[model samples]
Target: MSYCVGVDIGGTNTAIGLLDGERVAAKESIPTLAGEGPDSLFDRIAATVRGLLGRCGVPGDAITVGMGVPGFIDQEGGVALNSTNLRWRDVPVVARMRERLGVPVAIDNDVRMYVYGEALLGAGRGVRHVLGVTVGTGLAAALVSDGRLFYGGGSMAGELGHIPLESIPYRCGCGLTGCLETVASATGIARQARDLVERDGRASVLREWFPGEGMPGLTARDVSRAYDEGDAVAIEVLRRTGEQLGRGLAYAVTMYSPDVVLVGGGAAAAGERLLAPVREAMQRLLISDYWERISVVPAALGDEAGVIGSALYGRDAAAR
Candidate 1:
């Protein structure tokens, strides 16, 4: 049986897997060491794939490879143009991989893979319209309209997080002010919590949780714990975050009227602590005619979405 390799490259870590159709035959991770540049990163990934195939008793000729990354991508050519986190600029991903692996390769945006995974096997299964929201080191969205992932003119469509929220003044990681991501991402949530804790001078459970630690050192999980313990500040911070997320979702739904919205990534781990508020805000923002029918669900694929989605994309691309 023909097989495919899927790699999800991130700023800090990379997930690599082999897929025999939809079943993952092997999976592993390695430090992206992105600071070391693309040559080293790709070399390590290629080595990992070779190792995984060997361990699984699969032949190199039997497999292909696919990757999902952040930032602008030249999907047709498989070139990654300027991913700030990975520090890549116009990297010829496909040519390099093809030279080493002797197989066809495909690449696309990370969240697009998430959407593809959902459309194929997760919450978006059988749905004609799906919107995937990933809240992690950054926020991104992918839209599947009429059962196909929409790649707008520049292939940069569905960047929901980069949408500007006029009301918010916070600077975003993209170096732009007032982007929705600034107020709606995991890091953003942590930032708000830290700011509130420092400004309120309220006896924070976090203060006791980490004595003498600098306020900026607090993370999203720390705030999550505070919320679990009923800290009013943390509660308010997430509440606002959900509201911001809801506003963004509302705009997306109004435009595309997606049948379902799937939330994924690390922040989605907060579960109800995060979804409840976002749902509430979405309810308020959504028009009465559309509110009841639309639904939001967490990603069912979990961490496996990246590899699975990338493999699926590879299959389709190779067929074409």
Candidate 2:
């Protein structure tokens, strides 16, 4: 029997899944250890894939691999042009993976893979147009129209996180001041919470959560917990962050007019606390026709979406 392997490479962790047709048969995860560079990371991935197949008692014949990478990708060439999260540039990902695993490999932007999974098998199964946004350490989005992923002319579309927001004062890692991700991503939320407690001298449980100078070890999850306790500062931070994100999404909705907008990622786990404001703000900016028809909701597949999408994509690529 043939099998398809899906790999989702993230800045913090890498998730892998093995699929027998449409059903996932096995899964594994490991630290990406990105600082060690691409060669080291791929070595680990190859070993893990071998071990996974061995433990599952499956022969490695007729196997194909699909990968979801975070950043710009050269789809036809199978090269990672640039990945801010992985600190990768001009890496020959397909050639290296094929050498290590001895199988056909396919790749695409991670967010696009996530949207693909949702569009075909999860929340967006029947939707004609789906807009998927992930608010993790950073933010990005993908569009799936009529069951097909849309890659604009250069395969760099849906970079919503980099849209400039002049009102924001923070400098983005991309070297721009006031980029949307600086205020709307997981890291962005934590940064804003830290600034409020540290710079504004705000009275918040966040201070107690991360005591001492600069509130070392603070994270977006901490802010979400504080929001649960009704911390005024936490509420304000999420509200403002969601408002800005919604504003940015308003333009996307105006342009794409998706049937539904699926929001996923670590920060999205805050659920309604973040999405409520996102919906409110987005609707506030759009006219009745746009607001009335669109639904901004949480993604259904969770973390596995990328893996499933990648595997499915690989299966298709192999067939072609």
Candidate 3:
């Protein structure tokens, strides 16, 4: 059977998988070691792939490899222009992989790969027009329109997280103020919770969760738990974030008019706590005709989306 390998490199963890047709043949995940830098990280990925190939009895010539990584990537040239999370700049990822593995490689933005996974086998299966939104430490989005991923002229078309969010000024990692992610990401939600706790000075329920506290901090999971437990402050944070996400989606709906909007990533783990508010806000903000037409659903592929999508990308590259 023909086989392909997929790698999804994230800020904290890297997931690798092998695919045969539509089934996953093998899968593994490891720490990303962001502090170690790119060369070492790439070496580790190479070693891991070699090990997987050996264990699976897949010959190098029989499989292609694809990698999904964070940040803006020149997929055509196989170069990562800037990955703030990975602290990499102008890294020729695909070239290095090809030199090491002697196998064809495909590379693209991580979120785009997640969307592709949805398009092929998950939430967006059989859907022609889809918008995949990820709300993790950061927010990112991908557009699959008319059965094709739209990479804009500068290869930055699907930067949904960078969409300006009115006048709430705050510098983002991307060097912009008031970007959608400043309010909608997992980091953003925690920051919001911190701000609220500091401002109110009310005995926060989260204090109990932390026990011995240094500085007051709330993780996305903590906020989710607090929301579920009926903490007013946590509920408000998520509600506001959902509103921000809805506003961003409102613009995307106008521009792309996608039929389905798939939400994924860590913050999405809040589930209905996040989605209900987002949907409510979307209904309130969007034009009635459009709001009624679009369906926003959580991504079904979960953590495997990126790896599966990367393998699919490799399959496409091999075909080409």
User: Quick one: best lDDT, which candidate?
Assistant: 2
| Candidate 2 C-alpha RMSD relative to the actual structure | 1.8
Error of 3 at 76 (Å): 0.7
lDDT score for candidate 3 against the true structure:
0.86
lDDT of 1 by residue, 103-148 (tens): 8899998889877887788888888888899988678899887657
User: How high is each candidate's TM-score?
Assistant: 0.95, 0.94, 0.93
lDDT by residue (tens digit), candidate 3, 5-82: 999998899999988888888888989998998878888888888888888888877889989989889999999999
Ranking by TM-score: 1, 2, 3
User: CA lDDT, every prediction?
Assistant: 0.85, 0.90, 0.86
Find the number of clashing residue pairs for candidate 2.
0
Specify the poorest-scoring 10-residue window by lDDT in model 2. Answer: 55-64
Cα shift from native, residue 158, model 1 (Å): 1.5
> Model 1: runs farther than 4 Å from truth?
211-214
Model 2 C-alpha lDDT per residue in residues 58-81, reported as the tens digit of each score: 777567899999889998899999
Model 1 clashing residue pairs (backbone): none
